[model samples]
Target: MSPPPAVWVSGLRKAYASHLALAGVDLAIPEGEFFGLLGPNGAGKSTLINILAGMVHRSSGRAEIFGFDVERDFRRSRQMLGVVPQELAYDPFFTVREFLRLQSGYFGLRHNDDWIDELMAELDLADKADANLRSLSGGMKRRVLIAQALVHRPPVVVLDEPTAGVDVELRQGLWRFMRRYNQEGHTVILTTHYLEEAEELCSRIGILQRGRLIALDAKDHLLARFTWRVLTVTFDKDPGPLPETLAGFLSGAGENTLVLRLDQSRHSLGAVLTALQDLPAQILDLHVQEPDLEDAFTDILGNMGLEQP
Candidate 1:
């Protein structure tokens, strides 16, 4: 038989006073998949993560990790998952090495020094291993938090805004390590506002909006469904005024430039160029911008009648 999904949710719901944080959401992430969970602020992404991490109780329905029910088999489920939370919380007195060792002990692990050391090195925290948490920079502390979550070697890893407040160097380092880790068959669930990062890493993506799972599909499929290409035209001199037919497709404008949204099914680059020929603008340069994950995300949210960021 096929192995159970690395993570599963069914009819999950969470309520706070009169507000519903999660409204009957369902998701299934296969083992070894790199999945991205994206949503706007006040969406249920964090609430759902908190529920799976056993930090918050769900109002109804179920969550499971590797077929272990989150509520009934809490211990086993928790043991199989490692979560790097968005908040920066740590004991100021503890050194980086001490923190990870303590975290491993919390999961009933003993003699975990080797794994702890490896994690520190992987995260570029080896040089700061003996440094106290209070003395570390924000980015360094974030790396330590990631190490702490992985010290126990859980099969499933959840990273909630892991690269937030981190510098480009650290962010790149973390991505490299995570990519390698995920390629080794460990499941990774990431939630990030960096749509580009999600586009590069995640195989599948789930979009949450106002407590509902609005869209879920392979990354490419999602982009194909709602994203459109953009054609940017630059003129050598003033284009006078755009012709009526060509002006209809104008999505944006810059000094001597016009941006047009193109749907593959309805319009082609050849057609756009042909229409531009009749205009007074002498095309100095033309560029085609392919659709990306950010466009897909905005399109999805807009379709759902939510305010797009």
Candidate 2:
């Protein structure tokens, strides 16, 4: 039998005065799955995260973490979950080490030095363990936030834009650590506008648009929904005009490059190459871009509320 879901949200609805923040969103995240929540600003990603963290009460519906209802068993449910919110909230006076100890204290843990040191090392913050929170750089502070969330060793971890404003190397390192954690039975749920991160890290993804769950499925299945491919052809010089054969296929045009949206069923790459062979200018470069999570998100926003075939 399949293991029970670590996090289950059903018919989750939330509203603020007249505006709906979440509309009947339902999600089932299996144990050890790396889940992603992708959405643009104002798409209610924060609201959903808050609801799951027990920070914001839902207007209606239910959310459960490890069989503990969020509403009825708020403390227990929260104890099993760790949330690193988008905003960095910390006490400036405390050192990173003390901060983590305080967080561990809240969970009623004593002498968690082994786990705390392990977390510090994994996040590359062991050197700054005794440094005050105010003395650390933004990147270092973010690492502290991550360590604090994991102080209790929660089963489920929710990261809301954790890599924002961080360097590429750190971002890669974070993902690597997350992958190792998930492999070790931790259920990780991430919300990021960085489509590339979602594409690389998540096994399953959900797209939210205008306060609704627009799409949800495995990464491959969701990517398959974006059926169009884009080709960019840059000319050595302005071609002056596109060829007649290429005109109908062109979706956009830049100063020296033309963008074509090709449907595999109707046209092949060979045909496109053939049409551009006789162009006036030399082909400076050719790039074929496949549809990714961002393309799927754009499609979802455009086709929201419609049944996609």
Candidate 3:
């Protein structure tokens, strides 16, 4: 039989008292695929990741890593999966190298010094290898967390907001390192609030709303699904209130500029210009911005009764 998907979950559910954290969520990510999981603060993104990491017990359903069931085959599944959590949690007593070594030892990797050195070196943590975890800065702690997760060279890696609060340079470096490992045949599952980062790195995107999978498709398909465009018009003079026909489409307004949100299937650009003819003000400039991942994301969230941020 062919090897199972790198990561698979079926009918996953997690309940805490009356509130349901994850409601029958099913996901399958193939090996070497760069997958993105996106959701708002309480969208169960963290709950799902915790379940897969074996940190939280699932209320119902199956979760597997490389075909190994997470619960029954916990050892194998956990060993093959590495997670860089959002929390900057670590043992204050241990140094960077010592912490990584302890993490490696958890998987019966008694002699992982060579790989440990490589991880620290690649992550630019060699200089701080002997520094106590508590003494390191937040950025350095994040790097050490990544190193610990990767110490055993797992085939599947889950990055839960790995770049949260980090500087742009560090964030860029993190992506480069992740991309390099992903190209080396490692499956990468990224969960972040940053839609743009997900848009650039992930081939497949899955969005979760209040305990539900709201959208799942390739990045391009998701973008193409929403047929909308934003048009910004600059008037040479102060154009008072716009015509009724164009007023409804107005999404933004400035001193002498107006931005219109147009559903291409329903509103035509010609209609916008025709309505604007009623104004005596001359058109200084006009620009049309195409819909991107953010637009699609907002549309999805808005339709589900939640305001998109």
Candidate 4:
């Protein structure tokens, strides 16, 4: 038999006084999958996450966590989930170790120094365990948030821009740790504006726009939907002239190079090379860049052009 789904939502809806935040959203996240929730600002990414965290009341819909209804089994739902919120909200008076201890206590977990020590060491917070929250850097504080969330070892973990304001080294460390948890059978749901991270880490992705679920599928499938490719042709010297046919495909001409955005289905790379023939300069190099998650994100939201809420 298949393992239970970590999360399930059907016909989910949420509304404010004059606006709807989510409209008939439906999604199911299988256990142990790294899922990405991607969208521009005000695209209902946070709203969906809020509903899952039970921080927001839904107008209509059903949400289940580990087969427990969120509305009816609030305690169980909350117990099975850990959320690292986007914002930094922590008590400055507590030390890093103290904070995790307190958070675990809220879940009725007794003090477990071994677990706390392991978490601190794994998150690189061992040296800072005795330091006050106010004494740590922003990235360190973010680690504290993650440590607090994992104190009870919830089956599902939600990270909302956990890398925001974090340094590159810390970001890499965080991703590696998240991957370890995912491999160990913990479901991870990530929401971020960083598309590159999503492309690199998530196996599946969901794109939201204007409170609507625009796209949801495996990462490769989502990228396959965007077939536009970019070719860069570099010249030893500045090309003094251009072909008339090349003008249509040329996106821009930079210093000693020309960039073309071509639909790969209709025009092949050979065709692009043929169009660049007879230029007044020798070819320095050729580079091809494929569409990434950021490209898909722009294409989707640019198509919607929704007004702000």
Candidate 5:
């Protein structure tokens, strides 16, 4: 028989007194897939992840990891999953190596030093191996958190805002590590505020809005839903005011630059170009940018009469 889905949830809901953090979310992630969970703050992304990690009890519904029910088969399910939490929780007294060893021991991995060393080297934490946890910089600490989560080499990994507050270098390093593991048949799931990161890393994305799953689909499909291409033009002279015919498409106006959104279905690029040529301002340069994940995400939320948080 085929192995069970890496993660599966049905009607998952989590409520806290006055707030319903999750509202009946149903999702299934197959093995070897890189999934992105996206949402604005207070949109229930973290709550959903907490429920799946068994750190918070759900108000209703079922969740499973590799066919093991998260609640009923806690040990097996937990063993199959690793989570790099949003918080930086660690003991101050222990050295980096000591802390990692303790984490491995927690997972019944007393002889996991080889893998621990590999994690440190890959994450650029090898040189700080003997430093006290409290002495490490924020970026170094984040790396340790990532290494801590992976000490057991779980089949499924969930990185909750893994790159938050980190430098570009650390962010890229983390992405490479996750990408390599995902290619090796590990399921990688992450919740991030960076739309560009999600666009580049995730194959599938699920967007949450105010405790509800508003959108879920392949990244490319979501991007395709955005019917407009961005048109940016730099003019040799400032255009005081655009003509009535072109004003509707003008999304942004600068001293000598105009940025417009041209809908392929309703407005053609060539037509827009022709209209620009007729403008009072002389165009010096122009660029047509294809729709991206951020555009699609904004459009989706806009159609729902909601603002991006």
Candidate 6:
């Protein structure tokens, strides 16, 4: 028999008084897949994640982790799932090692020092192993939270805004670790405002809007749907006026530079070059950028008449 999905949600809904946080979301993430759950603020990404983690009760529908119902088999489901929340919650008095060990114990894992040590080394927390949580820097503390989530070696991991306040170097490191973990046959679900990161790491993406999933597909497919290209041209001299044909395509302009948007099916690179050649200015540099995840995301939301967050 095939293995159960890493995460499964059917008609999931959550209501807070008059507000409905989730309006019947249905999703399934297979084992070993790196999935991205994206949305603007108040789109219900966190609410769904909380329900899967058993931290919040769902108002309706069902959620499961590895086929174990989140509510009916809470303990078993929780044991197979690891979550890194957006907030930093920790016992300041506990040392890094102590905190991780305590988290392992909570999952009924005894003598899990081997995995704890491995996690510390992998996350670059070896030096801070004995330091009190209160003494660690914010970046170090974040690493500790990641390690704490994995203390029990859960097969499914969920990270919500893990790199929000982290520096570029730390963000790169976190992705490296996550990529390696996912490659080893573990499932990873990520939610972030960083479209570039999601574009690079996630195999599939689900975008939510106003408590409903508006888009879900492979990263490449989503990007391909835009069918647009960005052309950035730097001129050697100030071009006084753009030809009417070229001017209509201009998206932005700066000092001796022009940015144009091209619809792939309607416009060709050769045509753009010919238009530029007709101008009185010499082209210093030109860059043609393919449509990316951010562009697709913006276009999708715009078409739906929703404001991006």
TM-scores, one per candidate: 0.94, 0.90, 0.89, 0.92, 0.93, 0.95
Candidate 5 lDDT score relative to the true structure = 0.91
Q: Which ten residues in a row have the lowest lDDT in candidate 5?
A: 238-247
Residue 231 lDDT, candidate 6, scale 0-100: 94
* Candidate 6 error regions (>4 Å): 240-247
Number of the top-ranking candidate, with TM-score as the measure:
6
Better of 3 and 4 by TM-score: 4
Error of 6 at 61 (Å): 0.6
Model 6, 142-242: lDDT tens digits are: 89989988999899999999999999999999999999999999999999999999998999999998789999999988987887788999999887798
Residue 85 CA displacement from its true place in model 1, Å:
0.9
Q: What is the C-alpha lDDT of each candidate?
A: 0.91, 0.88, 0.92, 0.89, 0.91, 0.93
Best by lDDT: 6
lDDT tens digits, residues 1-309, model 3? 888999999999999997999999999999999999998889999998888889999999999999898889999999999999999999998999899988989989999999999999999999999999999999999999899889889999999999999999999999999999999999999999888899989999999988899899999999988778889999998888888888889899998998999999999899788788678898889899997788888889988889664
Clashes of each: 0, 0, 0, 0, 0, 0
Off by over 4 Å in 3: 239-252, 264-284, 307-309
Deviation from native of the Cα of residue 20 in model 3, angstroms = 1.6
Query: What's the lDDT for candidate 1?
Result: 0.91
lDDT (0-100) at residue 265 of candidate 4?
A: 82
What does each candidate score in C-alpha RMSD? 1.7, 3.2, 2.7, 2.1, 1.9, 1.5
Native-to-model Cα distance after best TM-score fit, residue 119 in candidate 6, in Å? 0.5
Residues 1-309, model 2: lDDT tens digits: 665589999999999997999998988998889999988788888999899898899999889999898879988999999998788778987998998998899999989999999999999999999999999998888888889889999999999999999999999999998889889999999999788999999999988876788789999998876667899999988877767777888899998988998886678889889878777888989999998887777777766653322
| Candidate 5 local lDDT, residue 265 | 88
Write the residue-wise lDDT of candidate 4 on 10-82 in tens digits.
9999999988889989999999999999877887889999998899989999988998888789999999999
Ranking by TM-score: 6, 1, 5, 4, 2, 3
Q: List pairs with backbone clashes in candidate 5.
A: none
Write candidate 1's Cα lDDT for 103-221 as tens digits: 98999998999888888878888999899999988998898888888888889999999998888998999999999999999999999999998998999999999999999999989
Error of 1 at 15 (Å): 1.5
